[model samples]
Target: MKKRWVLLVIVAFVAVGCAEPLTKTQKGAGIGTAIGAAAGAGLGQAIGRDTESTLIGAGIGAAVGALAGGSIGRYMDNQEATMRNQLAGVESASIQRNADMLAVTFKSDFWFDINSATLKPGAYTELQRVS
Candidate 1:
């Protein structure tokens, strides 16, 4: 029974490790924005200001921030896809679309030189065209 429990625990740990981890930047931005918004609104209201106006301002600020962040995130994703495709050496690429964004992943060995960060000129040009 002890051996079985040990094996189960090992398997569970391995499964957890295999799961994708959130990047530190993502975690930091999400937590920071939430905390900042709450703090800003609370401070605004504590100064004998209009509560409704404070809340509305916070809501508008959050919406604009979210939109800007999403655009920047998509641009970064495109850059990553370009790099991956250049390194992948594949003939064609596939895109996975989410509700508001797309993920492009490729398969092929022709995309990059071994252990090299520099992309082929052709690959760079192609990626530019796609973007």
Candidate 2:
């Protein structure tokens, strides 16, 4: 009985966490859920030495972890929005978000010449403006 319930819960969580096309919040939540479940299961086993207690603890931990992870993802989303707005006018530049990191790519057309290692004259002004 207790074993079945624990297995069911674990399976359900794994299904959700393994789903594809996940948003940032969902990705974070999935990671959090896995970590929280492992920690909770360990603590439950240590304290109660029972499957039922493990299930309950895992459920609680998963919920808390999801909330925390979602909050962080939301913050990152907002930060990306702000960065996009700030860099909207940058020439030949593109912004890319990789999880918690932001990548900015500037084309060399405005910064350098083909097969040249020296910076173009306009590049100085552009760099100043960006800085």
Best by lDDT: 2
Model 1, 3-117: lDDT tens digits are 9999999999999799786433353445555655665576557654898867865665555555555555556566666656564643556665454345776443445677787
What local lDDT score does residue 112 receive in model 2, on the 0 to 100 scale? 86
Model 2: per-residue Cα lDDT over 1-131, one tens digit each: 99999999999999979978766677788788888888887888788899998988888878888888877777777877877876788867789877669998999877889999999987887677655
Off by over 4 Å in 2: 1-20, 98-100, 112-131
Cα-based TM-score, every candidate? 0.40, 0.64
**Model 1 spans with C-alpha error above 4 angstroms:** 1-48, 90-131
RMSD in Å for candidate 2, one decimal? Answer: 6.0
lDDT of 1 at 105: 65
* Candidate with the greatest TM-score versus the true structure: 2
